[model samples]
Target: MTIRTFIKTTGSVALGLFVATLVVRGEESAGKAIAVRHSSTDDTATIQVAGLEKPLVVLHITDSHVTVADELEAQYQQYSSRMDKSYGGEKEHWRTKKKALPAAHFLNLLTLAKDRNVDLIALTGDIVNNPSQSSVRFIGKALNDTGIRRLYISGNHDWHYEGMPGSDDALRKTWTQERLLSLYPGRNPLCYAVQIGGINFVAIDNSTYQVTGEQLVFYEKETARGLPTVLLLHIPIYTPANTSASASSCCGNPVWGWETDHGFAIERRERWPKSGNLKSTTDFVDRVGKTGNLIAVLAGHTHKARTEKLSDSAVQYIAQAACNGGSRLVTFAPLMRDKN
Candidate 1:
């Protein structure tokens, strides 16, 4: 069974199974029950939960690199699951060990998001160390447990694994687009848009390491609608400071660089240079900026918690911390007037 054939045949079977499981579980509500709680913190300190006239709150979690079923415990236990292990070619070992943490972290993330009562949960990407059928299923189950509107985009690690002869096909069959729709109904899994509370949430696949033309088109269409939009993808748009050229390889591991064939390399850097892409980013900003309603650009892939001000524009670029060690909480409110 070649990879292509396996994709055709086995994919169907696996997708069917996934769909069935989803149907059975769809009616069940998961997550901690929201309790009526009050806080005495100063008004400014508390996150305003009263929905904006058109309030849109997004909880973003990224780069979980989760390994399902504790498969990587030995490696994680050996190295203590450090995020910086790649500096000396030791990343693989540590990565293997810490793989299970992502799944656990994902559970914790969901519980936290539920507590926040966010309008939506956005998983920016790197959900698994390498895409595995079981890992994806586990992710689906976890999201269902959270019971909030959710969206998932691809990350670099997601396409790393090549499916076995029949395994690839089996997994595909079990997780088809239609099936995902049934499971996550209304919120399209693969790259689509949904209007929640007058704001447009446009999810795109940035797992391929570069932005594609299709994504740009989607952006144009969504932005043209005059609705404030939130763009979700795995990799942050590479800037000069973080390009593969400027960053040294992780010892012999090519995965850490910006231009590597696999890892974070800027495979399409020429086409999407920092300035050119900045224009693209700006174009997006301008579209929404014109409305004075664009909230923030939410992303993941770096696995570190960060918020960069799009100075010339009103948009804030937010990156969520990895779910493994700690998760970052994002509070959204009208921009403070004093900052002006």
Candidate 2:
């Protein structure tokens, strides 16, 4: 899990190579090359994984936060406008310096993904500001027109309606099934897996900041396939060394347990229970560290980019938000050997 991180400036773009030893539990030595390129409008990363039959290229996009309310949802116009304006900040659109809208940033990412010939589009979460009909329909059509395979899961903002009446779990389930289900694959949107280029790309909805028992079982069954797996999640799982300054906002912050939320979630009117995380949530985190074939975890939510070593076997990579015109191109390739 050791890595040497360095950034190189190439004209207007900054290139980063995260070099690491890709060691799997009960496996021989393997090294992975991760090259990340950052520019004003978009960010891209290339990851090379061993034991693949062929190279698989994927475009990872997250947190676009597009806000579109149509005639059908006139009541939500104010909310949408507020959310949309929030993205006009420098951090949200570094490429255009707030000159472009959030919707524009999303369109740019889609165009870039197509131009790159990406095999799959991995959207971890927050594709929309809420489950509004207009935003959902707009995004769905755009994705369908691409005709490319995709994996999508929910984010906290994707389902929350701000003043909606109902618990977080209830609203998430209701809106996800009623409005967002079509955007996901198969019958279940909570957790699902698809194979691409001999690799298992799994997407799970931990947008609630907690994992359910059902999700844990789904994960177990998928990993049982024993294929090289990449997990897509909205929230990054807690690491043992979770004492970073971002503890207040990150998952698995020791203080994040039920009783000590510190009223951080009060403003949303829906706080995670004071009772803390369930056994299922903690169990899921434990299993992730032990899975032998697991290669990497792709996640978002902090609206920034981060990389953490999940274990000696896997690394968790959080890509920058698409609202800022960010993207990461991940390639899974067969292990190359030198011949004398």
Candidate 3:
């Protein structure tokens, strides 16, 4: 079956209006970052984190789906061309209101981030259509030029070499090491944590729609540190409210068990294990719900804007695809104590 592309224009962007305002209650931790209030305009969302000493501005970007190949990696040119056309490489930009290619849509976001003096750019996943050497290098160079701090993880497409001969696990490891490791530097490409503005940002690669035992343990240890935390992953964790018919229902789709993806595997020329999600994957999801210090979960696989209330205090924010000229500005500022 041929995959079809559809662009869903969000009311926030299309109507050029400010959406709802959410009051986030602060946690009891004395010095931890706490969400106080949230407000958003067309392309920006400002979140107030209480007990913060200073404001931290972060730009959330996802699913840029950059498609390009250098001469040496001509083997992937066909795949690149296919994805470029799928995303409408020459479509008009939503933010800039100008015609741009998929790559330009990504670059334009970086320019906006820099112009806004964004402290960090949190890229959830699918930044590249494929982990081609040239495509990865292009993203790295462009980001470095902006001198903005960034954290990235792979989406399914990021490490997949369509029609490649290998198990999904082996392919991911091989291509990630060969083409995408530089972006990670000394950190573990599968899972790692960083502290920016005293808030812990833990990133995990859940592109496979499953989590490994080691990653689960890593997540447990990281969030146990008791600081305000934000969890980032390529696929959004399962939520009952996500009733979309698209394959975007990821992480732990109830029916996504063994043999459920025969059509998907064949369509993408990739492997799906006969055994569905491991017990560890479900445990990870349960752990996410119970983690007290976790403030927000940010993800991007669906390429559509969404927010799911995970718990009374925690909300998951999903960004639209960057290829569709979508980006979100999230500002964390100290809460005004007297307001509450």
Candidate 4:
């Protein structure tokens, strides 16, 4: 999965919603950084939302890998499970910086969104560290709390593991269009579209690490409208703007910078067998570039905030995970015109 190269394993660490309503259009955002306060950690970002009567303020929150603390003890009692749960690397930040992955932190973010009057919230994915029913419920409840409309997508970890107490069949269930839509109100498909502030917001699921042929079709139809668009997804697409494609590589890991061959593309079938490609990864990026309408491609999986010039017209925004108490406040500035 070029898009979702993360999630080698559920325990491998890394991973992390909202709604919209009023089409409050104002002026193009000047791309200014507004300070947003949280009870525990204060975070801020400068955002440019393109092509709106007014700057459409969007909050990009990702990778809130949370599970109810109480549920864990219950599971232990039932299964007598002693699975090692110590996670390092990305999880370390939550312990040190954010205190812990408490649902309260997410509630704080929703409150901030309301206070700031964000138009729409793009939940790039991964609401749980592992796929537990309780974990999914926690995220679902959070989304319901936000009065504002939101677009939610799934990440690798969301449905990657089912390792709770009940010992019958605890296999990891992959997220499907059916299951996901059922969780959310109304009919939200695996790949769906929402219109906000004159921009087409597309929520896509590339959690399998591969974009399907059907997904390509779904996006193409949405972009055919030719309105300025923002693509929301789980994994961050590697572009020359952020990743060093020319960087040297050791085996598969980047020794110098990073490689683009697999990172940027949705490879075709027969190439990758484990999770072989369904359609050309280029199908999506190429369309965005050629059409020149997609202003931004926002994703999360890296658990760090970074931006890239995906093309002359569009910029890719990779937001940090909420487990680390992070969110990207994106203000859509007016899109640069061709003038040709």
Which prediction has the highest TM-score against the true structure? Answer: 3
Candidate 1, backbone clash total: 21
Colliding residue pairs in candidate 2: 40-95, 258-274, 258-276
Candidates in order, TM-scores: namely: 0.57, 0.82, 0.85, 0.66
What overall lDDT, based on C-alpha atoms, would model 2 receive against the true structure? 0.72
Each candidate: how many clashes?
A: 21, 3, 0, 26
Per-candidate alpha-carbon RMSD to the true structure = 17.4, 5.6, 8.5, 12.5
**Predicted candidate 2 versus true structure: per-residue lDDT over 1-340, tens digit per residue:** 2234233333233233333334344652222322222222135544444556677788888898887666887786544555555654434466556656677888888898899898999998989988888889999989998888889988988987766678889989889987997898565788889988888888889988888999988887897776777899999888867566554555555556556555434335377677777788887887787666667788888777766766544667777888887767766666543232
Ranking by TM-score: 3, 2, 4, 1
Off by over 4 Å in 3: 1-36, 77-81, 95-97, 262-267, 338-340
Stretches of candidate 2 off by over 4 Å are 1-42, 77-85, 88-92, 95-98, 258-267, 338-340
Worst 10 residues of 4 by lDDT: 12-21
In model 1, the runs with Cα more than 4 Å from the true position are 1-55, 69-100, 162-190, 240-294, 314-320, 334-340
Which candidate, 1 or 4, has the higher TM-score?
4
lDDT of 1: 0.45
Please provide, for model 4 over 67-133, each residue's C-alpha lDDT reduced to its tens digit, 9 standing for 90 to 100.
Answer: 5535543653322121114221233344346464345566667887899989877788776654445
Query: Which wins on TM-score, candidate 1 or candidate 3?
Result: 3
